[model samples]
Target: MQSEKLYSDLKPLLLSLAYHTLGSVTDAEDIVQEVFLTWEEKPPQQVRDVKSYLCRSVHNRCVDFIRSSSRKREAYVGTWLPEPVNTDKFQKNDPLAEMVWKESLSTAGLLLLQQLSATERIVFLLHEVFRYRFDEIAEIVDKSTANCRQIFHRAKKGIGPLPDRNPEIIEKKAAFAERFAEALTTGNIGLLIELLSSDTVLYTDGGGKVKAALRPIKGSEKIIRYFIGIKDEIPAGTRYETSEINGMPGIRLVVGEMIFAVITFHYLRDQLSDLFVVMNPDKLSHFNRMK
Candidate 1:
């Protein structure tokens, strides 16, 4: 009973760490569940700190999972994108809301995390996103405190600086999303072009399960044309609903009550920058609530 209570309380932090590290919601949940089972097998009294012990277990599992899945990731079709997790359901009292800033949960942010090696990713996330001290992270990663600091610094330099989380900037992003969605649904070509940056790019991930652009569509003009061309291709009953995906404003392309595609945008300054479209059925499976 004590173990169960501890697991329930720590589930949010565990999930946040795993999800941010792996960028896969499904796998994160699986890893956390595995950790819970392991916890159940051991007496809570045997653990020095339940939170630290569980976090270490999750981190180790993520490392193993990443090493094992590298081959599959390399062979993945087209551009591989992280599975988007809707954040609108997060309540004020949710632990995840405190553990991860909205910027850390952004799809763009997760993509940046992918550039990091497994150990670097875990160390960076622990220190940057979860605010763990070097000593705490050293113990979790089973490395010396100095080694962990070096790893964190290396990862930080690789990832550059974190995104701006100013409230005003956040509001601008929200407003931009609303305008962009209106322009898209209304087929306002002029407005769309004006909203997009000159070097705008669109990346689509279909996982070879469905048809999608095999390469990124670059330039504002090309992207505009692509959008125009696809306007007629949308299924008759398809409807779009704006929702918060991975902490950013995103659109869900639903056909007959099924969410088939998700679109997320990244900003360069105040202009609309990169756009990510996920049409892979496998990635969208976790969005069963859409039905």
Candidate 2:
């Protein structure tokens, strides 16, 4: 009973850690279940640091899972993207948890993680997202603390620096988002084109499970054409509702009771620079309740 209670108490931490490491809630839950099963079979007689033990166990399991799953993931057609997370469902008290949620929820951050090697991704998440000490993460990844720090530094350098935003720019992003949605829904391609910069780019990730652009659509004219074309392709009765995604205003597509997609807008100054449309059903699970 005591052991069962302990497992229950650690469940959230385990889930959060695994999810950050694996980028998939389903896989994270599976790893947590495996941990509980292992504990049941061979109970720990003494755990001086229960949290550390569980963290290490979960990290090891994630590494193994990543290694084994890489081949299958590489074969995935179209642009493979990380699963999207809904921030409203997660606990907000812990600073680390909040940061993890923010970083993981952002489309750009998630895309960057997908570009990293497994080791680099894990190191980056632990150090940058979770703020884990180098000494502690070294044990998790079986590296010297200095080596771990170097790995993290290299990873950070590879990803480049984040864009600086001012309050005025943020306000402009919101305003543009509202206007862009109205333009899209009303099929006002000219308005949309005007709002977008000349060098605007759009990326759509459907994971090849659904129909989406295989590559990014570049140029304002081409992007306008693509959005205009989508009006007819969407099923009848489908509706779009605007909402905040990763702290930016975006739209969600719903078909009856089911949420079919999410679109996030990236702004450069007052003009729309990049648009991301995520249409993969698996990726849309987080938006299930949004409708």
Candidate 3:
């Protein structure tokens, strides 16, 4: 196949798979470019089953990246969050697109995927999201079909508590996020506590470079207080808006020329369950590019 045609045809699928699996647009784009380079350099006669070949290549690259990333994660300064990707450029313009987009890229779902081992994560993402059969995944991950099945099941069990990445919840979350921003901006502790679930957990990933909680802050009261305590320090020009983040309703903060932070809210039953605040500059470096 012509290199240009080949890349054009597979880039979207590869990007979607890579972004969904790794949750990093920079990494995904890099890996996809590498695949294109390799395809161009290889002899055409060696190529067969283009779809499978591309998928397997990207899959292996993502797994390798994840394995390496896990080590860095251990030494990571504070809470770690999946790198958020802007979906507007790539998501299909259609009615069901929102639902499909969330299923493919919800931050909460991606965070839950971290519970699984690398192998299990690969199996679950391939089998559950991409709809790849066990046999097909076996070739991609180089595991036996039976082993893949076991891993997928284990991944599911580990991720059991996470609610489904349902689009129907978007409406509720949108309201909750607006409420959250209002509370945080105005330092309304009572309303903040009221909006948050009793068991709500707040995770901040400052990557040790910024001042943030080193560990998760649990419960509604503590979380509300945590925000209220910092209200005075939030810089001038800081603005918060409800935006599509990681393919779901989330908050985007901007201060002056820089993109300050991206916060993904996880909610259940109209109550906010978890908040993932990604403040790591390294992680947010690519934020402006995507916007």
Candidate 4:
């Protein structure tokens, strides 16, 4: 019972760490459950800090998962995207809710994290997102504090700068979403092109499960043509809902009973900078189940 209570209390934090590190709700949940199941069998006594212990466990698990999953991703077809989470489904006090301001929770940020080596990624996440000290992270990853600091520095420099993710964009996002939907639905290619920045890019994560651009569709004209080509696949009655995805305003497209895609946007210099389209069925299942 004590172990159960502990598990219940720390589940959110565990999920927070795992999901941010792994970017898969399904895998995060599984790892948390596994941690709790092990604790239940061999409950610790007089633990100094439950949160720290759980975080260490989750951190190690995520590293192992990453090592194992990289090969799987190599075999995964097409462009891979991180699974989107309906942040509202999390408890108000959940770290995911608390950490909404952090770029690590955004889809674009997660994709950038994927570029790091497993060790660098974990070290950077521990220090940057969770606010852990280098010494503390060193203990978790079994590296010296100095080594962890070097890894964190390398990760930061390598990732460079990410795009903005401001909560203040709510009004602008709604306006853009409305216009985007109208242009796409009405087949207004010219209007769509006009709304996009000259160098705007479109990233589609189909995972080869469905039809998607294997590479990013760059330039306003190319993206316009890509959308015009696939407009028929959306059909007429597919439902579109504006909701907060990864803590920012976005649109979800549902076809029949299935979620077709989650579209998120980034703006720069007052124009749409990048467009993200997540269509991996595996990635969408957890999001759909939450809805």
Candidate 5:
């Protein structure tokens, strides 16, 4: 009973940590369940902080998972976008949910984090995103406090600055996204071109299960052309709805109650700079099951 209660309390934090760390919802859920079973089997006798202990367990597991899965990711088909999570489904008023929403846990942000070493990624996320103290992070990563601080600094420098999350700016981006979605659905090529940056990039992740661009489509002209060309490919009875994906404004394509695609955007100067389209069934399984 106590174990169940503990798991209930920490599930949100642990899952968030693991998901952002590994960028795979299935893997993250597996790790979380594994950690929970381990905790259940061997209850700590003198743990001072249950949250910290559980977080450390998840972090350690994530690091190991990343190291083991590197080669598989390298060989993955087409562009590999992180699995999209529906932010609207998160538990309202939960601190962990708030943290997930506040930080750069977007698909693009997770892609950026993938560039760092496993340890560096963990350290950076703990200190920068989760606001863990260096001493706390040191214990979690099994490193000295000074070393953790150095690692955090180095990781920060390499990853560059985090994105701006100003409320007004976010509102403007949301409004622009609505217009972008409208233009695409309405086949307003002129409006679509105007909303896209000249050097815009679009990544389609089909995971080899379906048809998608093998390489990123660059330039507004190419992206516009690609979208226009693919209209006929969309299944009959498909509909579109604006949705929140990975804490960003996105569009969902559904056919008879099943989500077939999720399209997320990144805007620069109020124009779409980068767009990510995830049509991979594996990536959408968790999300689809929720609906």
Candidate 6:
């Protein structure tokens, strides 16, 4: 009974930890189920700290999953993107909820994490986001505290400084996105170009299964022209709508009953700096929640 109760209590934490590390809710739940199965099969006789043991188990499983998944992802047809999350499903006041949302939803942060090794990602997340000390993470990863600290430092350098997150600035960016989307759908290329920064960049991920720019479009004129060229090419039944995505305003493309794509806006003050469109059918699954 005691062991069952402990496992029950640890389930949510384990899920959050796995989800953040692997960036897939489906994979995270699978890891947690496997952890509990292992605990039941071989109950430890003298476990000193149940929380620590559970955390270590979940982290190890996530690391292994990432290693195997990375190879499969390499064979994926086109740009591999992180899975989108549904923030409304979790309680707003929960710290673990906030961490899951931030790590999974932050476009720049998620991209940065992709560059780190599995162990480095875990070490960096545990130390930076959860405020876990190097000693604790060292124990979890089976490395020296000094080595863990070095790993965390390397991860930090890879991510660099994140953009500012002031609410007012975010609102202004969202407003600009709304206007930009309107311009695109309405065939106003001049207005769209005026809204973009001189060095604006656009990235589209269609997974090679759909038509997309083979390379990123750079500079204001090129990006604007690309949007103009594609605006009328949208399928006959598709529609576009703007909404808040990853804390900033963006656009979602709906085809019939399904959400087929999401485009996130990155702004430099009031000018559009970058536009990221995720059209990979797999990554857009969560967008269905909006309906």
TM-score winner: 5
Better of 1 and 5 by lDDT: 5
Estimate, for each residue in 1-291, the C-alpha lDDT of model 2 and write its tens digit: 477787756776677678766767678889999988887889789876776677778878988999999998888777665555555344344554444455443566557666767677778777776678999888777889999999999888876554333557656676787788788778887788789998988888898889999888899989888877777888888777766565456777778888788777766767878888888888777558433
**List of clashing residue pairs for candidate 4:** none
Q: What is the TM-score of each candidate against the true structure?
A: 0.92, 0.83, 0.88, 0.88, 0.94, 0.82
Q: What is the lDDT of residue 13 in candidate 6?
A: 65
Query: Could you list the CA RMSD of all candidates, in the order they appear?
Result: 2.1, 3.4, 2.8, 2.7, 1.9, 3.3
- In order, how many clashes per candidate? 0, 0, 0, 0, 0, 0
Cα displacement (angstroms), candidate 1, residue 280, comes to 0.9
Residue 215 deviation, candidate 5, in Å? 0.9
Alpha carbon lDDT of each predicted model: 0.83, 0.74, 0.77, 0.78, 0.85, 0.73
lDDT of 5: 0.85
Candidate 3, 1-291: lDDT as tens digits: 677887766677677778777767688889999988987787457655787788888888888888888887799887878887655534545334343344564677887886666567767877776688999888877889998899888888866643454576667777888888888787777888788889999999898888889999999888877887887878887988787777677888888767778888777776888899988877888877655
Ranking by lDDT: 5, 1, 4, 3, 2, 6
For model 1, residues 68-88, the per-residue Cα lDDT tens digits are: 999999999999989887776
Q: Residue pairs in steric clash, candidate 5?
A: none
Task: Identify the candidate with maximal lDDT.
Answer: 5
**Which residue pairs overlap in candidate 3's backbone?**
none
In the range 242-287, model 6's lDDT, one tens digit per residue, is 7656545677778888887788766676688877888877666655
lDDT of 5 by residue, 243-273 (tens): 6677777888899989999988877886889
- Superposed by TM-score, candidate 4 places the C-alpha of residue 53 at a distance from the truth, in angstroms, of 1.7
What's model 1's overall lDDT?
Answer: 0.83
The pairs that clash in candidate 6 are none
RMSD of candidate 5 to true structure, Å: 1.9
